[model samples]
Target: MSETESRPAPSQLRRLPWSEDGKSAYLSTGDGASFLARMADTMEEGMLTTAEVDMTRALSVADEVSASRAELKMAVRFLAHAVADAVEVARLRGERLGVDPEAKETAEFLRRTLTR
Candidate 1:
């Protein structure tokens, strides 16, 4: 007979029953995964908000006004590198865990601003 055939019915199953070993036998790995996903959304929303772009613009302006052309170019290059590194990290993390990375709203926002 199947292992389940000898067990009690669903209606008779004890809810949230811990084993005699003092362990909650039913783990919540799925809940942990869901929580992480939600945290990712919150982070993405905060990170790519319009405020970030505004801050970038303000920093760019400050850099342009305070630094030489070469210095400003170097600073911008550093900023681009930082952005690319973050994107790659996000992409790799999503790929490893079979989840989609955050949306590319920052790129779209920049594109729209540039074309205007």
Candidate 2:
């Protein structure tokens, strides 16, 4: 069977249990909060690394117009992914702190837009 056929559908995946108001009500315990903070730091570092790589690639290809164009395209793709990762980190932090639900929703919307 093809890879697509072998995998379960999106709907078949286990979903996280959200609060009744469609918000994450579970406040992170001490350990959970620490874990979330560490993850956020890791994600931020990764995004910074991606940005640095994109800049290096762009600079290296500056003399070649065609190559520069390709590098710019790749940079945009990497930046988009980085933005999404940042958003996820923000979402996790917000969930841990029990921030406003709308803020989380807005972050998720921006992440989806970047992915598309």
Q: Give all candidates' CA lDDT scores.
A: 0.51, 0.56
Clash pairs (backbone) in predicted model 1: none
Judging by TM-score against the true structure, name the best candidate: 2
Model 1 regions lying over 4 Å from their true place? 1-61, 100-116
TM-score of 1: 0.33
For 1-116, candidate 2 gives per-residue lDDT tens digits of 99998666643332222344785433234334365455545655676576667556555556456665667777667666656655554554444466577977897799899999
In terms of lDDT, the best-performing candidate is 2
Residue 87, model 1: lDDT of 62
Q: Which stretches of candidate 2 lie over 4 Å from their true place?
A: 1-67, 101-116
